[model samples]
Target chain A: MIDPALGSLGAQIVLAASSDENHPPENIIDGNTETFWMSTGMFPQEFIIRFAESMKIALVTMHCYNVKTLKIEKSISDDATDFEAISEKEFEHTEGHLQTNDIPLNGTTATHLRFIVTSGYDHFVSVHRVSVE
Target chain B: MVKLRSRCLLVGDAAVGKSALSQMFRSDGAHFQKNYSMTAGVELVVKSVNIPETSDSVELYIFDSAGRETFVEACEKLWGQPSVLCLVFDVSSELSFSSCGRWLERVRAHCQGLHIPGVLVGNKSDLSSRREVETSVAQEWAQSQGLQYHETSAKEMENCEAPFLSLAQLFHALYQDRLQTIQNLA
Candidate 1:
């Protein structure tokens, strides 16, 4: 899912998508691949970590191929894991007015995956989809 | 013997004609001309539509949420309630159409582990000349996102009822399938 920030507003949007309905296997991911489309911006590292815990599998598409590839430092990948480590961390970093809850990790089979796609400036990665096997 | 009520949510960016379309459908020609001040938190309206085949009326509880970013939290409350979601956008606005991906992602993230049925709606089809989002582009995106897409005009009331009716049919079919499964188990 596309999260613009790590604040309550961003978290709220992510929560909304998770609660909708069960579309079915066919819709979840076409064939065997699920595409997650996202835009490039400053995403809260903690938020990404928390998102990984809930998802069985996540494929992040970096907006720009070249730039994103260059920016692919060890820190970004480390941050991905950092966010998933503690839900409270995400809650603490969010904007003041927004309220956040510790969403328990149900320990589902969903694997968290990442892919950076080109949106321009190879540094930007836009996730296209997430497929469940 | 008893009627079942299902809830539905209408979500999208501002000026997408969500409220206007809903008013037309719910009121049936009774015009309420007040800038309803953008659905602040979450506003709900209930209406019962009769199912012709079976003398039953399925009550529909619709939740309309504000499109502004500030109200995102309020919108989250309605997630994962076993309801059909209509993602509305303005046909004349490319930015609105492009934002669908983000909105869809938000819904998926919030309703974790739930596969919600979604319909992509492009409003303001009455102004054909000023259209910014092409029908083909919308259709392509809907296909990629696995959503049913329809272009409608609440102002003219053209095809306004179609989306709601189609969603009702989908819900009924799903309900019947579940009932059959239960009977088989019995």
Candidate 2:
């Protein structure tokens, strides 16, 4: 998770049960994982690079007070070498927005934007989900 | 076959020490730390404790959930299955305590009119001198809402045992009552 406003970034890796019924990995990143925290602004680029390298699968959700602050095109392109951006509307009822951009990388698709805020004066970005493939 | 125990849900605002409190009660030699960036979803930890006067041990399925506004809907879904609820807040931060009312309201609405016993936990009591919310105010609020309340610090381990222990006792009594009612019907 990356909180731009608070300038903090964290990562957790857990042993998750395999989705396949026949065979499951000894461990998977389901629920149990260690948590790490770092200042987001202090090491913005390094934070993104370190997270991408550490996990086999990575999902990135961008949050900002203003949608314009997202810089979705630049952030996604810069973070993952191989990625696809998709617009999704499934969380419309829960999020109060009809469409959000989904970024998929490392065989995992970032499905949700946990929070988004937009205003004339300030913009903030927070990433809520990331999974390693 | 392994039988899972009854579950209790812990709901609160972010950085309020819900995770730390859960670790202290469930994990030994627990240290204070904060790295939960939007609980992603619900995290479950299972711990077994022997009641003081009872021979049988109870397994607690504790769910430490995300406290972000965006996850409110997801939080609501999880609250439906809980047998009990622990509403936590940070005593040093008044905003967190105030948010408790919002959380409580949402939980009640999501429960579909079912009344589940809830306890308000004012965590981080070690920093009492720096406190923003007074104990009297919290107690009065809890009383008005008819919810049990406590002040605890997961860091200092103050009153940490009371909240969970009391809730466990309540669960035990409720379980026995239900059993008796079933027997009467039979």
Candidate 3:
């Protein structure tokens, strides 16, 4: 098991629809649950994480809140585009506590993973931490 | 352009209208989000406030943090030594007002003995009929804590700018005072 999202691993957040100086996309992989990246206000917010090298990922654990529908995609190309659908899940509504869930990819080989929050239970969604293995 | 920057922390209990007031100030009263979404983590917004009689302005980087206790530890990591504090509470909820002490203590502890200027904001002032925290009571508490007090109604868009403006002015004053001290040494 390995945390490919760590900065030491060279995981980079290539693109984020909304950017807040204090709460940037870097928080998603910072291994801290207290810090998070929040959407400005809109549906269909997406972010792409590029790994240092292609690896077979079996599971992706995410700690988030207000996320209703999450779609995961993967890409092996050098560029950020051309991602293929890997897994999608509808998260259960939670309050007061965080919504922690894991997505199984079944040993899929890819260098990049994209997470799209298509909808949220509230106007804003927060992604606390993401880790892959 | 003689611009200054400061990190303002907005912290309080859950559902106390911090987000609404911040959004209203950020949008200049052009936008007010009515949807109630509890902040699970910190939401940052930046705005520039121009001093009335001077060409200088202050850029406020507001850290609107989650109010829930479950996320406080994680939230504190994001709040890196705030320059000012905007502690908010609901006027209609006594429990919310009471929690201000704990919130203040948390922020104070995180500051590590730094003198951070701040304010106590009684939000949801439009709900005067259901008010649980009296103005005098809030004011006394604020005075005891060395923080200015203000009341606002984010729903009605009344006096939403006072708290932030006061903070900016206070920060600018501090900057001016420090500059004078340095000049005195020279």
Candidate 4:
């Protein structure tokens, strides 16, 4: 059986706004919802995920907690720059459980994806898992 | 740049200069309050220490608890699993120095045997004429407990920064080790 999660396809988080000892950026691509990358504090936290090669991504799923507003951008070049806005969503508040949302990417081809949390419902937020289909 | 934050619990008997030492380090040895009304509750002092030879830094949130036993019982609830410890005592008072064992025991019990690296600080070193605790004895005890020992005079702002700096560095070292472990897991 083949897993559809991009994490299983060797996606890696190359840049994160905050790198906490306990909750690291690596956790975002660990393919386990139980493990998560937590923001230390403040707003406008962002992370960039790099793929082995540019692939057609139609849908993106996220399991997050306490995140209010999120924006996504995609870059096809070798560098992480020259990105274009793909999708934006205002997540509902969740307590005791993760707020899971599936975002449509319209099958865009990209080598890197940037997820930015513009704000949070609380002082801190956690991104449990990011998968693409 | 691999920034980290840690909680440092400052504890000892009352009037042992825990506040003075933290204040001195926070202000870079600038202010030493001459007349201090004993801290009645838990006082929090935050300081940022840059680790040597690295761009990484550790933001130390120092919880300076009241020395009196009654307040300590209440302060214990606020500690919230301290990452490091700073056990202080007055070198001029043997009784205060003796209380070090009790404080250590209490912290050990509270942490449930978790190994939190720390330092043993002998404050009030300026009172050499009235000193009751010897450096050799304190050094031996600290070694037995696996803690680094340092003597400081908070009154004169002498060596007041060493213990806190050591604690920050110790925490930073721990973070580095953990970072390596996480990276290897990838």
- Highest lDDT: which candidate? 3
lDDT of 3 by residue, B61-176 (tens): 99999999899899999987677899999999999999999999999886656678899999999998999999999999999999999999999999999999999888777766
In lDDT terms, how accurate is model 2?
A: 0.52
TM-score of every model versus the real structure = 0.55, 0.54, 0.59, 0.65
What would the per-residue lDDT of candidate 1 be over residues A32-126, giving only the tens digit for each residue?
12222222121121112122333332222221111122111111241334212211211121121212122332433322322222122211122
**How well is each residue in B1-186 modelled by candidate 4, as lDDT tens digits?**
657666788999999999999999999989898897798888999888888888778788898999998788888888766678999999999999899999998787755455788999999999999999999999999999988999999888899889988987887776565434333333
Fnat of model 3, as a fraction: 0.00
Complex DockQ per candidate: 0.01, 0.01, 0.02, 0.10
**Which wins on TM-score, candidate 3 or candidate 4?**
4
The local distance difference test score of each candidate is 0.52, 0.52, 0.85, 0.83
Model 1: per-residue lDDT, tens digit, B137-175? 999999888788898988877887777766665565555
Residues A1-133 of candidate 4: C-alpha lDDT, one tens digit per residue: 2324446677778899887767888878878877778765445789999997888888898988878899999999988889999899999986557889999999999999999998776545778788888
Best-fitting candidate, measured by DockQ? Answer: 4
- TM-score winner, 1 or 2: 1
Kindly report which residue pairs in candidate 3 clash with one another.
A34-B74
lDDT per residue as tens, model 2, B1-186: 111134577889988888888888876536555555457578887776556776534467788888887876776666544556789999999899889888888666754454566688999888968899999999999878877889998888777767777666666555454323322322
**Residue clash pairs of candidate 4:** none
Off by over 4 Å in 4: A1-27, A30-133
